[model samples]
Target: MTAINFAVIGYGGMGSYHIHNIMPNENERIHVVGTYDISGERQKISSQHKHKIYHSLEEVLTDETIEAVLIATPNDSHKDLAIQALKVGKHVVCEKPVTMNVEELDEVLKVAKETGQTFMVHQNRRWDPDFLITRELYKKQQIGELFQIESRVQGANGIPGDWRHELKHGGGMLLDWGVHLLDQLLFLVDSRIEKVSADLSYILGDEVDNGFITYIIFENGIRAIIEVGTTNYTKLPRWYLKGTQGTAVIQDWDLSGEMIVDSGKKNIQAPKPIQAGVGLTKTMAPPSEEATETVALPKITAEYDTFYKNFYKVVREQAEPVVKNEEVRQVMVLIEEIFKAAKR
Candidate 1:
């Protein structure tokens, strides 16, 4: 296997995470040569991990041995770093929320085309096990023709860092967590989005939103609610999907959940109507026990190529990328539409 030498341009939380998760276990075909970060502290930290520290971005770009660059910096810097790397004839793997806006991503795509470099975004959630399970459920109709999907992630920690609280850095809950949720939806649903409505929350009173709720309607008769909140004292289930014949819920990252579907068994007896506060009703009565069944969500059978593996294959002209530039561009466009809808 020919190893592709890779350089990381940021040493922040996600940058370090990429090293821990992707770099070490990569097949002999990939390696993390070193890293470049303007932060001296981050440089010191990288040294502790046995990774060399580059003096500057230019130095890393000029090195012929390095074949790819990973941009894990703030949202605003993704486009510039990506373009610069591509111009130097290096493939790039940019973090999610590829750029602050679709136009910026357009500029990066132009550079990638001009240089013939393989450019892909790290929309890693596309490979998450929980999401994979949910996608399988939707695609296979395990719950029976899903029509409504609600996805959310909540935290009480508020905004995590300095750059995330400012608008200029492209800081907002929508751009941060929003990108992941929206990307997942776009990947799972094949229909075009017919409408989008959103409301951004400012409970923390920062210049940027702390969280948001986005409602998307797809042409295939699917309605999705993607939400992220920092002010919630209690979190909702990670996933709640409704279908014509049954419903499913995934409570958390642990994939703890179940599906309940009608069993099509006739009731042996009629339900005894219970009185409400002022009236008796049978319409809201629970289904007979024999009429439904609860089952574990079927395990999903899918595998994802690591980000670097795909990068190498694409650069070698051996295969197409899992994260194509056009799909990423559409995600950015949807994000813009979401922002517009929230502001209206």
Candidate 2:
């Protein structure tokens, strides 16, 4: 099989990750041609890793051997780099928050459509196991319909690196981790969004937000709260979802959590009143011990290829992109509205 030669741009954290970890996978359809970066240190590192390093973007784009380019640069540069790559007849795999805003994304997509080049965004978190389990619970109603979802990612680290702390480079939690959570929610919910409310966090005094909390309401009555925090000394559950007949909690990336589901047992005894701060009441007391049952989080598997492998299929076999441009555009649209809502 002839592999599609891929050249990586940026060679920074994510770019370097692509070159070292992602592109060289068992997918025989993808081949790494080389990498390009402005930083001399990164170039030396790339060369040390036995990769051909291009000094300029032009060198990579002009090279006939490279059929596709992965844009892992700063967010501000994605639009221009993607447009240029597509203009040069190279299919593009862009990192998330595809553009600073949807308008810039539109410009890049316009060129892609006109040039007939394949364009896709990373949005890799859709494959995350936590999210997959949640999706299964939501669809299968193993517990019942998920009526409310509280998703969060908290860390003690203020923010990662310098560029992410600035506003101009699209550095912020909203654009950073926020896009992933938003994309997952949008993908999980089939209903249209009825309303969105958000507030960005800048407690760290950086030009960009250190974190944010967004509440979304869907037409089908799904209420979701998506949040990110970089200052939490203690973190909450990564996912907290409430369904009609059960409640699920995912503590963290380890996927340690459980679902408390209705026991469906008749003649359950009522909870005895417990001591309170000053008052005695049973209204706020926990349900009887027999009222609910604890079960393991559902195990789920996706019948889709990994992002790089899917890119190969899309570019080589004319298969639909696992992460489509339109879906990325929708995520961008939600991001725009989120920023707008924060302003209000």
Best by lDDT: 2
Can you write out model 1's per-residue Cα lDDT over 184-300, one digit (the tens) per residue? 999999999999999999989999999999999999999999999998899999999999989999999888999999887764566667787799977777767877799898787
lDDT per residue for candidate 2 within 234-260, as digits (tens), equals: 999999999999999999989999999
**In angstroms, how far off is 248's CA in candidate 1?**
0.4
How well does candidate 1 score on lDDT at residue 68?
Answer: 90
lDDT values of the candidates? Answer: 0.89, 0.91
Q: TM-score, each model? A: 0.95, 0.97
Badly placed stretches (over 4 Å) of model 2 are: 301-305
lDDT of 1 at 172: 89
Worst 10 residues of 2 by lDDT: 19-28
